[model samples]
Target: MNESLLGALRRAVGEPHVLTGDDCAPFLTDWRKVVTGRAAAVVRPGTTGQVRDVVRACLEHGTPIVPQGGNTGQVAGATPDQSGRAIVLQLGRMNRIRAIDAENDTLVAEAGCVLQAVQEAARAAGRLFPLSLGAEGTCLIGGNLATNAGGTQVLRYGNARELTLGLEVVTAEGEVWNGLRALRKDNTGYDLRDLYIGSEGTLGVITAATLKLFPLPAAQRTAFAATASIEQAVALLARARSMLGAELTGFELMSAVALELVPKHFPDQRLPLPAAPWFVLLETSDAEGESRASERFDALLSAALEAGEINDAAVAQTMAQSKAFWHLRESITLAVAAEGKCAKHDISIPTSRMAAFVTTTDRLLQERFAGVRSATFGHLGDGNLHYNILQPKGQDARSFAATQQDLSLLVHDRVRDHGGSISAEQGIGGLRTADLQRYEDPVKIALLRRIKQALDPRGLMNPGKVLPWQTMP
Candidate 1:
């Protein structure tokens, strides 16, 4: 059966593209290196027609198909299971910018197009594709849409779902659904485009997307500020929103510990302000020139300082300085990985209760797990916190890693108590299926299961992800 399926895949996407043995190793592991699996073969398909043929071949043989793009997901959603009975459907070869309608402010890109390339294409067209992420250079648009990624700019432009108008998906049955309408107001039936999105490939494979674009900002201002506490950071966010309004594009909150890691690991990255308990990095885009942007930023920061919302602040005076400020923020993830084993939680809480939640969670963690350091930060404007807990200094790495489940459970329990979601920007990939079952409402879970059964009855679409294997028929 494995040989038959491999033969079909090879025929569909060429023999050279059907990788086996040592060549398949790269696609079997996840980005975080937390979980590794095995696959029968790794198939790279270059076109939607090839994707459809691969899906059909897998379906005919009753083989599981794990759709993968860029393999940059935090969770193990793109990895296959240990059975070695499935094929990793890699989509990196299908990268292409199909079309760009500047008048409609939309760009159609293949699923494998790198996000940074898409942004550059939009810039070349005198427009802006506002989905900015730390991994934009490597992460593909399909994965971003599959996970509904939320980046720093989400405060103003919203997540990937909002930025996307339509999708070209190859369903579980190998049928192409061309719902790639660029219309802003389409009152269609079921909204199938959204159904496939954020599904993590459980329902279908996102082959391409029609993404919305906006006019390039005349000027963008970047600022970094130090705050005494999370409360002050939240207050500062409120002030920015009130004064800057729509111009405020990004607002990120970082712990002093999180920032300290950047300079500790990278050594070249410098902090702009003195050490404090918390810091905020914000950006504002003005349709008007730099003069207007500078004026608004000055008013906002000055008011924040006067009200004691911030202890100190520094605004970037040049484009190089602005990129430097953002680089520091983006470097936090790599710094955390370099530190040691981490129990990471991507959670979202109401901005109103964010301060209390962080304070209480920190205290509870210290009380229960002695000396577990918190390296926390994330998009404060959109209420998504990358709240990560690092192993204590001088602790046994394996022992500390073992406590990941318990640590995450406690944090997620508190998240539920505070009316927050356990999984925020990162979808419930294979890593959090158990957590999803634990924290999610039963009714919602039942509905999700039903949708899965309805869309992919054979359960061949990325099995053991988002929904547990035991729950599937």
Candidate 2:
């Protein structure tokens, strides 16, 4: 039966595109290398019709399908299971900017299109896609939508779910739903597009998207500021929002420990300011000229310093300098990874309670597990923090990693107490299915399972994802 199904898949999307053995290895592991899985074959489909055909073949043979894009997700959502009975659907060949309507401020891009490519396409058309992330260069737009990604600019522009106007999906029944409408005001029923955006391929395969665009800002300014504490950093965020208003595009908070790792791992990257307990990297996109943008940034930072909200600040003088500031912010993840095994949490809490939550959680972890270090940072503007707990110095890395479950439970329990979410920007992929079951309301989980059953009745669409398989009735 497996061989017959593989033959059908090869027929649907040519034999050359059907990958097996060593060629399938690359698509099996996730970005973080935390989990690896097996597959019968990796099927590359170049068009929506081909995707439909592949799905039809898989469904007919009762084979599970794991739809994968660039495979850049932090969670192993795109990775298949150990069953080896599934076919990994690779979408890289379908990459293409189908259309760009500058007047309507929308662009249609296939699921396989690299995120950076879509951004470049929008820029060439005198528009902005506004979905900037560290993985934009290699991550696919489909995966971004699959996860409903939130990046530095989410404070102003919003997440991928808000930026997407429509989607072109191939459903579990091996049928294409062309709901790619560009209208802004559609009194539609059910909102099926939204249902699939963050569903993480459990419902259907996202083949392409109709994405919203924004006008390119006239001038942009960036700054890196030092703060005495998380409280100070939060205060500065409030001040920036009040003063800059809509112009404030990004506000990222980084711990001194997080920043310290960059210099230790990459000697070339210099810290712009003296180390402090906390730091902020912020930016503003002004409709006015460069002079006006610079004036606004300078005024904002100076007021922050004088008001004692921040210790010191450095405004980027040029675009290169601005990129450098962002580079430092982006490098935190790599630095943390270099240190060794760590317990990571991507969570969001009410901005009002963020400071208290961090302080309390940090103290509790210290009390519970001695010498565990916190290397935390993230989009403070949107209230999402990558609160990561690193293994203690001189401790056995594996031993420290063994306590990850307990560490995360304490942190997530605190998040629950503070009115926060366990999974923030990152979707609850396979890695967090158990976490979802633990923290999420039983009613919500049941409803999600119903939706999955209604759409993929055979339970073959990316099984063991978003919704846990064990608890499914």
Q: Candidates' lDDT values, in order?
A: 0.94, 0.92
Clashing pairs in model 2, backbone N/Cα/C closer than 3 A: none
Per-candidate count of clashing residue pairs (backbone under 3 Å): 0, 0
Tens-place lDDT per residue, model 2, 170-245, is: 9999999998999888886999988999999999999989999999999999989999988888899899999999
lDDT of candidate 1 over 1-473, digit per residue (tens): 37788789989999999999999998999999988999889999999999999999999999999989889889999999999898899999999999999999999999999999999999999999999999999999999999999998999999999999999999999999998999999996888977888999999999999999999999999999999998998899888989989999999999998989999999999999999999999999999898898888999999999999999998999999999999999999999999999999999999999989999999999998899999999999999999999998999999997888889989999999999999889898999999999989899999999999999999999999999999886
The regions of model 2 sitting more than 4 angstroms off are: none
Tell me how candidate 1 scores on lDDT.
0.94
RMSD of each: 0.8, 1.0
The TM-score values for the models, in the order shown, are 0.99, 0.99
